[model samples]
Target: MKICHVNLASGYHGGENQTLQLIKQQAALGYELTVVANPKSPFVAAVRALPCRVVLANHYFAAHAASVTADCDLVHVHEGRAIYWALIQKLRHGVPYIVTRRIDNPLKKKWLANIAYRKASAVVGLSRDIVAKIQHAYPQLSPYKIPSSPVTYPIDETEVNDIRSRFKHRFLVIHAANMLQHKGFDVTIAAAKALQEQNANVHFALLGDGKAREQLETLAAGLTNVTFCGKQSNMGSWFAAADLQVHPSYTEGLGSVILEGLNSGLPVIASRTGGIPDIIDDHVSGLLIEPGDSQGLATAIMTVQANPQLRETLCAGAQQKLTSFRIEHTAELYQKIYQEVKSSL
Candidate 1:
């Protein structure tokens, strides 16, 4: 089937990454694909790499709606602004589009969101919790749940070992996300303090940078164990070098990094919020703690550090569950969705 995928996000985060994965794999499956993404975004490169067309629409209000409609049998939108453009495409040219909502944050302008969801051919959330939230606010709209793909980049073992050796004596824990309040930087800092009180020989490599970095860095002042690793391109290497991943986010749509961690066969200790529970089971695939609970986060870290057997068990479970979150599986589900939506039209 011919498809047009739209994403207006400027940065290539988890949601954008998911879009790239689906488009690339589906294109390989013989689906003619076209992507309309922000011109400034690095995501344009990925789309160009695919056996597809890449239309650079930097603004949400760009005038490429008619052209995008002319090229595809079905339209799929990935992010917020893209949803708005898709709505216009549907209204003006009668092109039906499906939306994938990736955030748990409540819709600010209810009327706008209601119009888009109602008009869309199908709406999908990345997890059960996200679907529930969508259903609650817009009861007329029955949302489906299709999750993000667990895709990790290749890592060189020699490079991974070299990075690991830099922190030889300390147990390294990695937290990767854009430094946002909802991401639970405060909770992680508190846990770090707790670790420090006990003089634990553990170090945190906090990856990704955002507006909250200055404030968080100020709060973590004097905590030498914490290192602000402002956005690294090689997350797979970091996963390989680290002991485990810690994600104590107060809110998350699906926590793609956690899935990436599991994909790398690195066990994770994450807060049980939003779609986290959908991917991770407590003491099963990985460890889960209550959101914003520093004590619980600290306790889990300590438990993992104390027991070598627990790490082995979590990694084993993660490997077993990995197939379910693979990009191939995600692409198959989306292919089914595309067929269903297209046939209805």
Candidate 2:
């Protein structure tokens, strides 16, 4: 089977990483794969080393559709704008296509989304919450619910031990997210401040880069417990060195970092928004706090810090859950979807 994965985004984030993982896994399974991406995107360069075909094209709907549809058996779109062009191509050529909705952005363009859904052979929702939202928005566009398949983000276990040696016995807390307002980095900083006020001996590490970095650094000013390490290419060491992972985002389709933290045996403290609650069973694998609640976040952090046994229990549960989201499992699910759509076509 020939599969074409389409993403026009310029930067590499969870969605692009997931798409790359899928492409690598599927190619290993002996399927022909092609990636349609932006010419100037770093993502395009990253995937060049992979064993798949890469096509750099203009972002125009008509041009991209015309170029992609001719040689591909199925087009799997990973972004909304690309979905529009893919739908147009599918309608024009009767080729089957699928889309993976990765965010919970309010559907301001509901009509356009509906049109794309109508043309798609299948829609892949990364989380059940997103699936519900899509169904609610366009009841006519019934898409399949395939919660974000879990995969361990590339992290080396050896580097984790090295990081632990560097931290030397200090209690480490990691927040790995883009420094965006909606990601709630401000709340995390405030929570760390609250912990420090209470004389807690904890070190907070911010891992990721974006527009809000300077503002977040200002918030962390005078606080000796916080460190902004900027963006990291390898997080295995960070996850391995940390006692806990905190994600205070206002929304998420599914927290892929939470899954990565769990796979690394780190307990997570995340916001109870979007599809986060589905992954964190409060006190089971991780703890959930209300979005933007600094006080609640601080208290949860302190509670986990105070109890080593509880942390161990949660981490163990997280490791067990990791098995369900292995890259192989996610690849198989996509393969099944591709097969079904192909048969229908």
Candidate 3:
């Protein structure tokens, strides 16, 4: 099957990574693929060696005029703006398209959005919560719930030991995400402060950089236990060395980094919102706390820090949970959707 996958975002964040994974899997399965992306996007370089074509267009209008979707069997829109590109292709050439919504934010009820969604062959979400929100916005649409798969990176044991060595006699707690308000960096900092006040040996390592970095750093100031590591390229080593992962995001489409922590055998303490519950089984695979609850987050961290037996149990459960979220499984599900959408036409 020939598919035109559209993701015009410039940066390669979680959503872009998921798109790359899907394209890689589909291409390996002998499916011909064409990518409609911004020339400046890191995603283009990521797919450089793949057996697929790359069509460069800065915006939906440019993509439409370029006629990139003319010969494809179906179009898979991976980002919001790209949805309009698919919509125009559908309207102009009768090409079927599918949209994958990765955010849990409320879908806007604009006229163009309504038409674009209504005309989609399938609307997919990365979590059940996102799917619920989509349904709430458009009752006539039944969106598919297809979460992202966990990506495994090679662990450099030397690097892992080096990271662990920096925090001697300390239990490392990792919070990996873009330094954003919705990502709850402030909440994590508050929890770190509480832990520091208690003179705990736990160290909080805040990874990833964003516009909120300076603000988050200012909030974390005077806390010797908190360290801003900035954007990390070697996440596997950090996850391997960390004792636990704390992700207290106000909202999450699906906790992709949480999945990585779990895959690395680290017990996670994440917020009980969005599709997080779908991954964390509350005290089973990991512990769950209400969003913005700094005290609760600190308490959960202490509980896990004090109990080796509980951590082991959660790690065991983590491995079991990862089985259903393999990239191959995600690809197979999407291929099924693609085939169904194609056959229906």
Best by lDDT: 3
Please report the TM-score between candidate 2 and the true structure: 0.92
Candidate 3 residue-wise lDDT, 68-160, digit = tens: 766789999999999998998888888999999998999998999999999999999999899999999989998898889988878999999
lDDT of 3 at 219: 89
Which candidate, 2 or 3, has the higher TM-score?
Answer: 3
Candidate 3 backbone collisions, by pair = none
Per-candidate TM-scores read 0.96, 0.92, 0.97
Give the distance in Å from residue 146's predicted Cα in candidate 3 to where it truly belongs: 0.6
Cα miss at 229, model 2 (Å)?
1.2
Model 1 residue 119 CA deviation (Å) reads 0.6
Task: Please report the TM-score between candidate 1 and the true structure.
Answer: 0.96
Of candidate 2, the 10-residue stretch with the lowest lDDT total is: 60-69
Q: 237-341 in candidate 2: lDDT tens per residue?
A: 787678889999999989888887888788899999998887788898889999999999999988999999999988887777666667787777878888788
Task: Kindly report the root-mean-square deviation of model 2 from the true structure over all alpha carbons.
Answer: 2.2
TM-score for candidate 3, please give it: 0.97
Candidate 2 runs further than 4 Å off: 62-67, 150-166
The better candidate by TM-score, 1 or 2, is: 1
Q: Considering TM-score, where higher is better, how would the candidates rank from best to worst?
A: 3, 1, 2
